[model samples]
Target: MALTTYSFKDLSGSMSHPTIGSYIFTGEGVGDISISMSTDRSAHDVASDGSIMVSKIAGNNGVVTITAQQTSPIHFWLLDWYNTLWNLPTSEWATTSMLLRNTSTGGSHVITGVSPQKVGDIPYQQQGQRITWALMAADIQHNSK
Candidate 1:
């Protein structure tokens, strides 16, 4: 018999920008991370004649969402990036590159032409809350190695 083990700690990622250098993403203070395609690979249309046609979709876009505790250093790092970009002139604005990897499985997701879709929501309460950041990518490639 064979056994395998996995841990959220094995899941990590990084973001790089011309201005911010690079920021690592670990399990520390992070709640969850997700990557999804903007659209499916294919679409179908049914005709009145009981025939169906499938059209291929050119969907190279994707979104990456990261949830982290407000107390996490990453939370502050992202906030800084957000504010910095906001203050920069449009001519100085640039895209970010991100890489998400699973050490356990040697799987990785690479995102390019990345930009923050919106600022993360802020919350104040007795206990800390998780802030979600959604990033849009013009190109995403997945490698399952």
Candidate 2:
């Protein structure tokens, strides 16, 4: 499938609900937003005689790296959401509902557990006050067929 990335937006063009390619993304920006997934995994092995045996290995949840940017008012709101969600007292991070859809291939997955940024310094534009944020997805779906 020719799955190219595209900017996701609502009919009214609000950042509240957006998608990157077929995957739903949430951010406030006007830029070349992208989504890339990496599977969480573990591996164990045993060495006996002259051979190595795989003891255990498994793929856990995954992460979706999101990069996006916004100008002015939207940037303001984006910063607000990121600040509030991460600065809270809760140790367990909250997740947002995300969906990955491939209409051409008829495949999809529902992901949860998106983390909020709190501890790091978010980059800001010097000119137009453009807010560009690089988000790493905390948890994600496998996009099972």
Candidate 3:
């Protein structure tokens, strides 16, 4: 029998933007990270006559979601980036990029053309809230060692 193990500590990631510089995630302040393609790789259509067709999607667009604790520095960093983008003109807006790697699995992902979907929502309560930030990426390339 073979066994495999995964750990969050083995995952390293960083986010970079021209206007706001960069932030390296250290498994602190961050609760979770999720990556997904914006669209499916293929689409299929079937006709009543038993004819089938498949369309290939050329876009490599994707989305990355980051969840951070309210007290974490990463939360503040992302907030600042969102604010900066909001105050800038469309022509002057800058895109962000991120690199995520899993040391244990020898896997990595490069995400480019990133832009925030919106500011994280804030809620006031007894317990601290976790902020979720959604970023759209024009392309995400996954590599395996």
lDDT per model, in order? 0.86, 0.45, 0.87
Indicate whether candidate 1 or candidate 3 has the larger TM-score: 3
* TM-score of candidate 2 to 2 decimals: 0.52
**Ten-residue region with minimum lDDT total, candidate 3:** 88-97
Better of 2 and 3 by lDDT: 3
Name model 3 segments beyond 4 Å from true: 92-94
lDDT of 2 by residue, 1-145 (tens): 7565433432111122222112224333544434556553544465676565644444334444333444444445556656665556454345444565554444555556555444324554674433445445655554534
Point to the candidate with the largest lDDT: 3
Compute each candidate's TM-score over C-alphas.
0.91, 0.52, 0.93
Model 1 ranges off by over 4 Å: 91-94
Write model 3 residue lDDT over 23-76, tens digit each, in one string. 897878889999989878899899999898999988879889999998889899
Task: Report residue 86 deviation for candidate 1 (angstroms).
Answer: 1.5
Q: What does the lDDT come to for candidate 2?
A: 0.45
* Model 3 TM-score, 2 decimals: 0.93
Task: Compute the lDDT for candidate 3.
Answer: 0.87
- After superposition, candidate 2 runs with Cα above 4 Å error: 1-48, 72-77, 87-92, 117-138
Clashing pairs in 1: none
Q: Is candidate 1 or candidate 2 better by lDDT?
A: 1
